[model samples]
Target: MRTEISADKVKGDFLEKVEELSGQSIWACYQCGCCSSGCPVAEEMDLLPNQVIRYVQLGLEEELLSSKTIWLCASCFQCFSRCPRGIDISKIMDALRQMAMEGGVDRFGPVEISPSELAKAPQQVLVTVVRKLSA
Candidate 1:
């Protein structure tokens, strides 16, 4: 497939870092579909695991960097373990997640809560439990 991104589109070491961290060069993927078949989240992904690998191979930076599938990955390592080529599919997803975050796409979804909001739960129950334990 044709890609919108040229070699000049990527800046600095982003793609290099992705390849390093994922432990498999994009060129090594033969599109055998083993990774996609074993992926638990494959059915839910906007692009299948094999497709994502191909996009990366084509240097489709924008598409790979902004995909919802990157965040949807639960990091279960199933895909990584099952890949016949031994490509680290989970790490590829992780790298994609980092790229997406750096690009400000917010992979957690449209209305994800901020860290501050998640920490504001009531503390009274904890206090009561502590007091009871102390008695």
Candidate 2:
């Protein structure tokens, strides 16, 4: 597979964008592992919550984008609430996922559906299910 991996490549604007959306300074992360421990989906993730933060800090954009951990996160807010650093890990994940999708990073494969893809599905069944669950 063709690939690209570069460290310390995060553009300043990219960091600013993420910081703006997450309301957490990326530098504030202390790697306490609390986010990973509290994450309900961490066991199923390719990268733990703390690992994700580390990747972002290192500017490992491709690594972060290719990781399934972003999708695995159910965004239940446990990580965000339990974080001692007060870093909004969920929001950071959310920002990264959005940016990755916009950049056509292919974090999820062509046939694999990320949650964002579910919104574009022509079938109403999944939407109905989500609605019922959210209700």
> CA shift at 112, candidate 2, in angstroms?
8.6
Q: Which candidate wins on lDDT?
A: 2
1-135 per-residue lDDT for model 1 (tens digits): 345765665443555777986777776789999888888888889889889888776667777776667766776788778877878887787777766666665534313444664477456634533322221
**What is the lDDT for 6 in model 1?**
58
Cα misplacement distance, residue 27 of candidate 2 (Å): 0.8
Count clashing residue pairs in model 2. 0
Q: Which stretches of candidate 2 lie over 4 Å from their true place?
A: 1-13, 105-135
**Residue 10, model 1, lDDT:** 48
Local distance difference test, per candidate? 0.69, 0.72
| Model 2 lDDT tens row, 49-77 | 99888777767767777778876666688
